[model samples]
Target: MHPHSPDESPAPRPAGSPRSIDPRRLRADDLRYLLAVSRTGRLVTAADALGVDHTTVSRRVAALEKSIGLRLIERGPDGWTLTEIGRAISDSARVIEEAIDRVVDTVEGQDSLSLHGTVRVSAPDGFGTAFATPALVRVRRHHPQLQVELITATRQLALRPSGFDLAVVIGVPAGSRLVTEHLTDYTLGLYACDDYLAKYGRPKSLAELREHPLIFYIESMLQVGDLDIERHLPGMTPAFSSTNVFAQLEATQQGAGIGVLPAFLTQRTQLRRLLPDEIDIRLPITLAVRREAVTHAAVRALWAALRQEVAERADELLLE
Candidate 1:
């Protein structure tokens, strides 16, 4: 006789198989999977929403039914529907989910004001250097135990739960996994050093702007297309280009060329605004973080500090 195959010890159960079950054996995963199915009414959709495969969702639902000792779902060619028992249990699952979220919020809230743990923040080079760094200095002074690592780059930082605790963004982020809050709107104006204007002759009109050398963002390295200041002055090109805003600012300060800079930078510097009356540009600022990271105390503390810092310094950030 052929040897029995170990894998054939028992055949896999088909959908809605009749079998004995123990309700007390169910776990939180079982309930959550059931809730997903209840909300979506299809295994494929539920799997997609929960970031799992349809097979996993089917197995989870089957396991939940087996543990509850009842068939809570009616599966058909069209879709799945919760039976009366399934609906009742799904309602309970929602309550359980809410309760769990509340528990997490309470724990996180209790420690929201905590002065511990490291928070990693990502922001644009200009904002990070000219604004975020100084604000963080005050945040650090208040929370001696808390540490901050500010990552600055010209391109948008890839947002991930493991990457950064928070990000200050100039444009709307692409992914759905991140939650965003409007931080503030700020203005930018064309500026040049007194020496540069004296040498190059200040342009009194938009049409005269091209006569002067311009310092602007490097086109190849530009991430946000709206940041191309030359867009406002058609046919204009930069005499000097850099990926870093601070570099452009310095170049402008050294009388290399006129550069469009944030109001906050210009207000702090002795740079003279060129055609200030004609050039009016406004950009929105947003604070973003992974939805999963919102419950962390360190993230919350940093978020509050960033908001407060922006609000307190609105005069410096926004144009008059």
Candidate 2:
């Protein structure tokens, strides 16, 4: 693919342009522009992070590439993406940023270097509130300038994940480009409100449980294979369905039907677990990050905070 500089729509130069870069002419500081573009994936957003105008961001990045005699970034359908070499340069930029942060700490004392820029996180509704929220909030405590945006949804992750710096997904995807690791294992079990069981009569067995209506995700639209009800309960279908887990929970609370919900979600609710031995369905939650994004201080800190939260909340995730 031909690389297009985001700064300008230019006329093609003559063939055999020299690709050699002069080390003396290279401006190391301009690497900051490249790092900003890598983080935001657009000239305008990067400019916003740096407190500069979009055109100036473009100009500085262009100058940096010219000094190196290589195309570091190229425009794509959504925004700008880094080339292979550009990713390497971003790593170097991260090191420089770390050093700068260290220098700030030396000058101003510990926890003084406030990490700047926004870090976006994509997660499920329940996990977003229960786990990702508190963890990201702690990151803000350390680096007050860092911004965290959490997008909550229960759907399949995009093939080429763009806006978000981190993704917490339901299962380990088969063919995903992002770096993934097992975040935690959580169980889903049959749950019913006290009123529902009181009125409709509690089921003693799996067969009896299937007799009542079930409240769950819309089967047709559910992209998460791990949440498939059929895999856990054979010959069972949801009587009421919604795309959102919270909606399903609310429906279950209204005594609409029994819900197959995460154990963590029902902690404070009146929902009572049913047939724990027979109805428990365990699933894995995975954390994914872009290849180039892991180097950023904010991203690394976010993951670290998230991991610690999960570890500390082990009892909540997996009830004994």
The prediction achieving the highest TM-score against the true structure is 2
TM-score of each: 0.63, 0.78
* Candidate 1 C-alpha lDDT tens digits along 1-320: 11112332223456787655455676877787876665455677677766899878877777666566567777544367566677677756765655655566577774434455456778888888867887888778876756687888766634322245578878666666578998988888899889887787989887788787888888777877667665666777788998888888899899888897888887778898778778878888888885545665557777888888888889888875
Instruction: Report the Cα lDDT for candidate 1.
Output: 0.72
lDDT (Cα, 0-100) at 288 in candidate 1: 88
| RMSD to truth, every model | 11.3, 4.0
Give me the runs in candidate 1 sitting further than 4 Å from their true place. 1-113, 157-162
lDDT of 2 by residue, 1-320 (tens): 23335453333345878555567887777888888787677788888877999888888877777667667787766578777778788767887766776787778776655686678888999999999999999989878767787989887765655556788999886434488889999988888999999999999998898789998888999999989888988789999999888898899899999998989999899999999988878899999997778767788899999999999998898874
Off by over 4 Å in 2: 1-7, 10-18, 21-34, 40-81, 96-114, 174-177
